[model samples]
Target: MFRRHGLRATAAACCATALLATPALAGSDGPGAPGAGDDYFPGYGNGGYDVSHYDIQLRYQPTDDHLRGTTTIVAKPTQNLTAFNLDFALPTKSVRVNGAPAQFSQDGTELTVTPSEALPEGSLATFVVEYEGVPSTVEVDGIKPWIRTSDGALAVGEPEIAAWWFPSNDHPRDKATFDISVAVPDGTEVLSNGVNTKNASLAGWTTWQWRTTKPTATYLAFIGVGQYEISTKTGAFGQPLVTAYSENLGELAGPAKASVERTPEVVEFLTGLLGEYPFEAQGGLVSSEGMNFALENQTRPTYSHRFFRNGANTSVVVHENAHQWFGDSVSVDTWRNIWLNEGFASYAEWFWSEAQGTGTAQELFDHYYASHPADDPFWQTLPGEPGAEEVFSKAVYDRGAMTVHALRNVVGDEALLDIIRTWVSEKRYSTGTIEEFIALAEQRSGKQLDELFNTWLFTKGRPPVGEATGVPVSATRVAVAPPKAVAEIDRTHALLHDH
Candidate 1:
């Protein structure tokens, strides 16, 4: 998941090369690859260049759901390229490569840009793209990732939201910093990833600027434009803590606040287990829209109001904030390695349950292991290699957590904690794989773990009721499933609506 870190040229230095003339498609010069070559969604990220930053400016109108924007991308070409592709779906008005007008065409979601001059290998290139459209109408495979709210829109989803709102190297493999500025009606609030740096208003419009201090995956970068009750504070460590609740939340607002307000505490708890928090900020967002799933959108995770309909549900909050360590900071190498994200986050919920005295981690693990039968199909799908279609399946979340607990049993609590701390410390802001994680665990624990990981993650069938499953033969098992608050976290992924 880690690419070689190359020396990057400044945007100014790259734009200066705009004087070069366009070259014929001969010799070693050609077009960039259309995709980053992921086994799951091959057309996700673009090749031939690595993106370092995205400066996006947009004005959104809620009434018509119209969005207009100018996005600037700073990248370094991995190859000499005549043309390159950006995963985008909106109607592109214009494109400039290195400040020179470039010929561009849109074929579905792929925006192919032919620079006025070839972008030489190892040279930085700056691309500016202007586009406008109703994001809700831009559909691919009958799916629209944009969520239309009563007040504005929500740019949130996993693996596929960036293309609908902005042009990007839309893959976790290509992590980049972001500066997102959105102009909406003066009274409408705008929230995005990272810290909200500034807000200014004039002529009945307010533009909010947010900047990320750390590299973020394309899907992890999000924007919400709507009426929100925003809150801000400083954490014990002095990091900014900001949260937003949609004004339209109505009855769910109180519970949402009750749960989300504890983000700083959850961050503190997770930091104790996973080492220092990785980002410069911490927070959560609760949306009133119809989005059914909660997304770990970088520093601020976004949730569906439904997560708190029953009452204050911090279990869901614990699940997402834990992702700040597992998913956001240490991303998966490819979609196939999604267990690295969901599994670890799900395990955090059980960890929180144990800390809260609601249930023991062993009891929770035993309940799940005993509940699902050998032929339950839940055991048939391997979490380590859940194919593209079932990447978000039950096996990835529940079975994935079980796998973590199994490893904890084999390595003991102290060694397992050391392994987790070392894993995140080493892979922070980068991508990792199951194999890498297994090797790290073995190295830290000083024990052979290949068979343990294989049985828990690869081989499907439920492990025979024994010590290998992380449950002692004489341990007290949960009489029934844990309370709904904890159980609901596992069911949230299954109820995810189409993005």
Candidate 2:
């Protein structure tokens, strides 16, 4: 996530006016544990089950900001299960497990469902949950991740947006395929991840249908319901490219279009380095709403209009799409390993800059290395193991990129790119860890890199200015600032990095 400074919560508390549908239910049993064992977010995903796919159907009325939905989940329990938990905040009317009425209750965002009978280990079970609520009213720790726009709603965020809009396992560890269909007024355009398989219109409402065959993290699945100027085109590699611009964007529309329309070019550029483009489609959505951050939501990314405030900026474009390979494809096993996402994506910005004749990756690395002094607090946060509060800190982003640059200097360009390609291919649709990445890097480069990684990623001070650390303060160091886009990112790093 890339955030601008001074962004405030924009959702208003609206009452849900949709009528609730009665659900079948029997006697209640017990609720399952509410976490999937990630220490950073203990209550995120429930344990004991693996989700295979989700079929979500939603109806939204922009006038009242009310949302109604039914979500069907296909999953299997790892062990015999009487009940399981789904991370959701909407008020549920009813729930069914395998066509039988199931007792359900919600404690905060944890929706505990007790099926009529225990599911046998390895048996596939189906869960159907019907819910209706005003998504803007849902809050977690005083933060509301859902963005309610004037024309419609934007269901986007990191680590937590799915709970407010739909029931989910709610973690990167439990990735699943998605078929999301959103029904809205005729004039509204609904944009989501993956392909637009179909669109059906009835009366004055239209249901925008979309599906993703690839396994995607719940946080990466999103929907934008609003009035948008939609465009479709074939990409450089023959993949479908879809881009949307909010009709309300005034002066920012041109710059946003100019930058995002280059998605094909950017994807082709990244493909040369990261092996192949992982997804089937490529696109971007530029919201006119005053959002401070841009999110990489699976196949299509959502950008804040503020990213183009100065002018056309493709660096942020590179950052979010680079996430397709780093954060989206090969996800972090745990949130603590976030540098694997942010660092590599940030390094992609440097790579793009060099390709555009703006700045070399080394020049960008050296600029950041010299910018922060030894006593700077920026060096205090360890990028490899940033705690919950510091997960999106500047250290995780810039220092993380510095770490990648340092690795490139030590491993050589060919070895570093090969290591990245191998890592992407090996961990294609699953999660990865820092340890695994370290081992792979060392193995591929034929180097003992523990000290180098530890000094840059784990230690709590500015690394020495030397070749070993990749910040050689020799005559090669030129006194030049990075491009405006990078300088803008540096300026925004001091702001909130909300998911």
Candidate 3:
């Protein structure tokens, strides 16, 4: 049976707001009010656009059976446009812009709105979307959204699943800041991006206000509401960070805390290695009910309860933590360049492994190289390749890790570290493409890498190995070894050389 990633199946609800639902007064400041700013607009086609600033407020309430909310987004248009389009990734019940009813079009996955009034370049525009629905189950392939049994856990993966809860761009390229307020059933907890600015109690419901100061990719935006035991800590930079796990999983808290307690250390390590921690307001981790792998949501990294099963290994913690630097701090401009996110995260796994004495960094490279398909067609496939379905594929993850490893080999460890540090320092709070990364690597390494990348990235099959060339051997005396074993041995030898 075909399986869909959870994000793709349940994301339909995220785009469900109607474009021209109601007209509101331009100056009216209601529950969902737009903030003062130049009408910020995101470019749709060509190179994706950036949302430099946004002031938005959302009023939401969730009953036992249904979730409802209205969002007002004030955006400054970065580019000139006569018509403004905002993406509601789900089916919308209603939409209005600047107190005027707007025309909307839908393609199931996107709700595009065109305001009745022409928006001038650099003008401020306000968009409002009101929606209500039964919280959809996240489904991908056959995998369904599930929560881990551990305490205070909630994660939204399957990229862009947040749209199921709110109208959004649902694409990674479009980045923005958000002010999210959510009301959950009385006694339940709610978690989201940014710092918790306010909390208030209403009739049988609790309201939470979360404001993210950093620019964020739409996919990294998140919300989780349920009963959870809250924990807090301070990073080396003194940034306040929090973690919430289910009360029932209280027993796992110690291990979970121990596993992640080094978050500050990891952050510091990455800051020294990469540049600086990208999101400064706060960082968080929420254990979620799910059998799938962890989802590196910005600020808050959602993890499966199982991850805490074995004392929250250093490798896993570092992997997710690394994302705060690579994925969250320096986001990929498009899904095709997802390697820029996942690959770096994967590489961090090796970096942590090497640091913790689990293995040398070269060992990690050999492991990935050994696992790579000899006849992989990933290089020939673009980010939006016809058959490609998910961004977490081997091409984006493992192969991408190998690319970084190869770069390290090409530039040596110290220089590779310098390149990464510069990349993060230069691109923090911004988005980058693969070509830009390649250029950055070249500049830092002081060496041409086009041929190197072509051999590993563009080739249809694995490039010829140095010693793999045909050499006559005594067939009768030749020793035969299992392919897997031989591969492992070869990798280990390569690792020794690399180290």
On lDDT, the leading prediction is 2
lDDT of 1 by residue, 183-206 (tens): 998899999999999999999999
lDDT of 2 by residue, 38-152 (tens): 6666667776678999999999999988999999999987767777889998899999999999998897887889898988767889999999999998776576788898898
Q: Candidates 1 and 3: which is better by lDDT? A: 1
Which pairs clash in the backbone of model 1? none
TM-score of 2: 0.92
TM-score of each: 0.92, 0.92, 0.77
lDDT of 3 at 263: 72
Whole-model Cα lDDT per candidate?
A: 0.83, 0.84, 0.57
User: How big is the positional error of residue 496 in model 3, measured in Å on the Cα after superposition?
Assistant: 28
Q: Please estimate how well model 3 matches the true structure, expressed as its whole-model Cα lDDT.
A: 0.57
Ranking by lDDT: 2, 1, 3
Please give the range of 10 consecutive residues that has the lowest summed lDDT in model 1.
1-10
The pairs that clash in candidate 2 are: none
- Per-candidate count of clashing residue pairs (backbone under 3 Å): 0, 0, 48
